[model samples]
Target: MKTKKHTILKKSVLIIVTFLILLSLLGQTDLGNFSSQDNSEFNYVTIQKNTIRYLQKGQGKDILLIHGSPGSIEDWNKIIDSLSVDYRVTAFDRLGHGYSSDYEYSHHIEDNAILTNQIIKQFNLKSPLIVGHSYGGSTAAFMAVNDNNSDQKYIILDSPLYEIKMQPIYMTTTLPVLGKGFSLLFSYTISDMFIENGLNDILVSIDTNQRNTIIKQRQHIWSQPKVIFNKSMETKNYNSDLKQISNRYPNLKSHFTIVTTKDTLKTFRKDCEKFHKEIPNSSLIYLENTGHYIQIERPWAVLNIIRQKMEGQPSSYKKQ
Candidate 1:
């Protein structure tokens, strides 16, 4: 009787495992049609081996937008229309994200900065104002410090500028074969759900329409295994990159306008404050009742800040 009971228990466990495997496979099937067919309106440029996808509109001083981890050019959709009205707005899918060609995750911030510079040179953008969000902020800072172009100014939107505690989940993706397998499984099985939940948490003040568009764009990119791996590498290596930036912080020449939110994560806000203190010339602005997705929540406010900066206004913000 005991043997029979053990056999039954084993069978029950096998059945449960089989059911879960089937569920994961079914989820992949449901999301298999991941394509950027909706973004055909954008143009592409081949920078080296990577085919960088971008959208350019209006005509004025170049306003380059760089998105964060697991993001694409579409992240600027909410504010692009408004900003394009006054400036020549350009946004691109960073290599290994969106429709761009896949590349190995080098975990060095300078790699992205170099690619950004290449894009600027290829398009012959004359001292464009680069606006970088989240991880893109690091890229912008690198560009300012290294490119040494006197005309370049920057707006960092809710970026992680100081040291950060790496999450174990992110570290897992930096492993060898295990990382590739795990990234593939996550991307195929639950990337959309992860993207949706993350967006909901970060974009607390966004409207339904804007939220939906952001989610769609992020989901399309997050579903790709290469993009997922790249994000993992970025998170895992962020602390090292921050250390390098800290060493070169004083050398940053481009003027900066840093934007943050009242509702930002405690650690992230602390980093922002540290960044502000280190860079005395940089201006820091706080938006009340906002989260990490400040660009989407308060596009008009961002536009005003940009306009003020362009008009040569003095830097002002309450010191924390």
Candidate 2:
């Protein structure tokens, strides 16, 4: 049995190595060739000791884009150019997502926000505009409400699960049965395919060939032992202090929300609505013909809406 297992491991490693070689040979590792009508480009930024991947593009007023669970920075690739035209745009892979190494302490959003705040401060980004999607949206909200006297505008994009309901992924990450491997082969492949299909469904703009290339690259890169180990250790303890943060939303600076007409919005709609109602300056826009991934689904529309808000227009946020 031991010898057989050893042989299987060797084969797995060999396959991963071959896949990497092919990706390099075919130049399939890039974020994809977005249109050149946009002059700006995304450049990866590394924060030491994080083992994470981030992209910061353009040079102007800052806008940080945060992606959801199990997603990478490419989630915002569709809108980076549009948003970056006026605001410096930054996007990053959350821990356990994509090239970002799942660290021992990054399973939840508190540490993620702290690290991100540090990144902002380190880079000296003046008065950043934060845009968070799903889980990333929650982090940006918490960060905004808690960062007293900070100059950050928050754009929450379809964030659902919060500390109040505590998304069940927390428990699953800690499960003993499935904890041996961060994911079983069946679940792994299923989740991978789910993401690929989700992107196609929501982001109808990306070309099929480039999308396939990115999906294949993701599969090959995650075929490693380190990711599994990190996932195992990342299951315990998250933001126990989100209530206090949520309570202080009225004090946050420049809050905007995208309430996409997607099923995921049902999870925390009551909470988000209550927060928006109480927060004096917060605006929530309902995208009429889009889903949870509205930023990707209608990048141009979101960009225009954000620009209108930034330009201090008398905007109508609700759908007619």
Candidate 3:
């Protein structure tokens, strides 16, 4: 009788697992073809089992453009045309964000940094310039400091989460029973709040219609069980390791971090200011009246700043 009961429990677990998988597939279906609507103003390539939609254009020095959270390659589309003229700029949606494939876990900066390094190697591209915005900025900084041989200069524009670091609330929740419950909550409800509320908070300036469109897409990315599971696991901050990196930077001196047109209340802009001050020979561009999304808001200005960083060209950008 005991053996029969054990067999029943095993069968029940299998059935539950099968249901969960079907639900995941169902969620994907709900997202529909979130791709076709986007005309490939920029081209794309695949990695792993997923597609990495990106715009690769121009020549000269290779530049890898990284977008912020919950954004796709299109986020850089507004500036791609100008950036591509001088440098070979390649910008893509990070894993699990847009059209890119999801990671085993929704890996954060370190995972994305490693992924970028791999892509750089796979394409046989040079160490190239690394330009990142928002979370992408953080990832680019990680790669720049960590990459021993990448011939890369770093451009950080209005990075929202710089190092005003705080431990993620989820880490505390993930402790023993609390953690497992948090895992469940994050995998389900908490992700919804992040999508619904968090997007609104950041893109507060977006008009009603445009904001609604993003919110719809945001909701879709969050609802996926796999994505929620992956992101929830990424609640830790590895910025402390960055201090060691900064100390090694002058030797790793091929990088430049340009903090353009400072956004005072906009998340981590001040941290960029702090970092800019700390690093020797690094200059900060505190452009007046500039917001967090400076690259999209002002492409020529951003490109000019980048040019100065990469080529040591004369810059029209003045000190803040």
lDDT of each: 0.75, 0.59, 0.62
Give the candidate number with the greatest TM-score: 1
Candidate with the larger TM-score of 2 and 3: 3
**For candidate 2, lDDT tens digit of each residue in 1-320?**
99999999999999988764553343321222121112234334456555556677677777777776545676777778777767787776666555664435545567778878877876787777677777777777767666654434666777753354434544643555344333443234454564466455554345678667656654544333333323333324334545546667667655565455434333345556666776666776665555566676567766766666566664345331
For residues 1-320, write the lDDT of model 1, one tens digit per residue.
99999999999999988865664454333233233445568888887777778888888878888998767876777788888788888889887787776545375778789888888888888778889988899788777767655556788988888776776777666775456555676887777897888778777776799779878877876778767777888888888887776777766666788888877553267667777777646878888777787777777787777666655776444322
Candidate 3 residue runs with Cα over 4 Å from true position: 1-51, 105-108, 148-151, 160-200, 203-232, 238-251, 315-320
Give the range where candidate 2 is weakest over 10 consecutive residues by summed lDDT. 28-37
C-alpha lDDT (0 to 100) for residue 247 of candidate 2: 61
Ranked by lDDT, the better of candidates 2 and 3 is: 3
The predicted structure with the larger lDDT, 1 or 2, is 1
Clashing residue pairs in candidate 3 are: 106-230, 173-179, 174-179, 261-287
Clashing residue pairs, candidate 2? none
